[model samples]
Target: MTRAFIFPGQGSQAVGMGQELAKSHSVAREVFQEVDDALGQNLSRLMFEGPIEELTLTENAQPALMAASLAVVRVLEKDGNMDFAKTARFVAGHSLGEYSALTAAGALDLADAARLLKARGLAMQEAVPVGIGAMAALLGLDIGPVEELVAEAQAKSVDGGICVVANDNADGQVVLSGHKEAVEAAIEVAKEKGVKKAMLLPVSAPFHCPLMQPAADVMAEKLTEVVIAPPRVPLVANVTASEVSDPDSIRRLLVEQVTGRVRWRECVLYMGEQGVTELVELGTGKILTGMVRRINREMTGSAVQGSQDIEAFLASL
Candidate 1:
């Protein structure tokens, strides 16, 4: 069966995420150690045992999630000899997980990916002051209605607030991000439009929207400092939902992704159209795998996050 390796983004992190994997596999420990050394912090400790508040911080959570995901990838490679280039049809990730995908596909060095995510997290958090911006998830609404809702919300912004679609996650799940007032307006509008559910997200900063342009600028500079090589497999980028292999294009898209909507639903649909029969999510949670089912039920979805999951996947292979 054709396969694609996928990774999860933020909100998938939790305390004790990769502890068991590290204990069971030396390879997994090595992956976490490399990320810790690269960042000069014991991030693995944070993942294995966390004061949830600290671990949930954007700066810590981004790289921490990547480390956990890479630990799984390393285990799969060393234990099963699964070379992504030959075994997988494509690689893709949501938001910060894109960095994890690049690292797994050999496009970016592990250390570089860790450092880049740290910088990205810090930049994103600092782009807008806390409480000034917000994000809201509007359930039971498709992109078309959400876009019109965003327009209506924007029109109601007397203080020039901005509200736009941030993540097009699945058929009925869309996230809006921007000025707090604007996002709040979007939530109200969504409710008025008979959305299934509309609630403000508990995120520190508005992500994947124009309010993050400052973060995008910082990433533009940080990205140039790192080296990006061609991945072993093509990456279906979150911004465009298309296959991209050119290193230059990858770099450009990474920068744009900071302020662009994460087209996750489209990305999954594109992969299905490309004949990817299975999506293997190598990360801390089954969030992406669940999204895959929502996007295309015909496509199988598997999430390998722990040792047992790893063994099961290898045996399947």
Candidate 2:
């Protein structure tokens, strides 16, 4: 079956993630070490033994998740003898996981990816005052209806009110992000429209919305200084949800993604349309794998997070 390698984003992190893999494999351990050197901090320690709150910090979590995903990819290459350049048709990631996908696809170096994510996380956190912005998931409603609701909520709102779809995650699950009052209003509207659930996300910032414009600006500056190579495999970007191999386009899309909708559902559908029958999630959790299945039941999903998983995947291959 044709395959695509995908990576997970925030919310998939957990204490002790990648610890077992590191303990068992030298390559995995080295990946963590490289990230630690790049960031000039012992982030792997935090990932292995977290205070939960500290590890959950956007600055720490962003690069930490990427490190874990890359560690898995490194191990797979060393032990599994699988070459993504030849085997995978496309690579994709959710949110910050896009950096992980690029690193795996050879478009970015792990060190640069880690440092950029750290800067991105801090910039995003500082974009808007914490209590001013919020995010909420509107379940059981398609994107078409949610867009209409968001417009209505914005129109009725006061001030520079903005509530936009952040993640078109899957069928019937679209997450909204923007001003607190506007988001709350949208949640009420969603409930009134017979949505199954509409609730606030415990996020530090209203990510993937206009509120993150400052963060986008910060990323634009940071990305310009860093080199971006053409990926070995095509990347289905988060903002566009389509294949993009050009380095310049990839760089611009990465910045736009800060304030653009993470068209995850569309990305999965596009991959399926291109005949990618199986998707492999390389990270701590199977969040993207679950989303892939929901987006297209015809596609199969698998995850490689530990040594056993790698062995099984290689044996299957």
User: What digit string (tens of lDDT, one per residue) describes model 1 on residues 1-317?
Assistant: 99999999999999999999889999999999999999999999998899899999999999999999999998889977877687899999999999999999999999999999999999999999889999999999999999998998888889989888999999999999999998998899899999999999989999999999999999999999999999999999999999999999999999999999999999999999999999999989899988888889989998999988988988887
lDDT of model number 2:
0.94
Model 2, 1-317: lDDT tens per residue?
89999999999999999999999999999999999999999999999999889999999999999999999999888767888788899999999999999999999999999999999999999999979999999889999999999988788787758899999999998999999999999998888888999999999999999999999999999999999999999999999999999999999999999999999999999999999999999998988887777789999999989888988888877
- lDDT assessment of candidate 1: 0.94
Candidate 2 clashes between residue pairs 3 or more apart in a chain or in different chains: none
Find the 10 residues in a row with the least total lDDT in model 2: 152-161
Model 2 residue runs over 4 Å out of place are none
Go through the candidates in order and give each one's C-alpha lDDT. 0.94, 0.94
Clashing pairs in 1: none
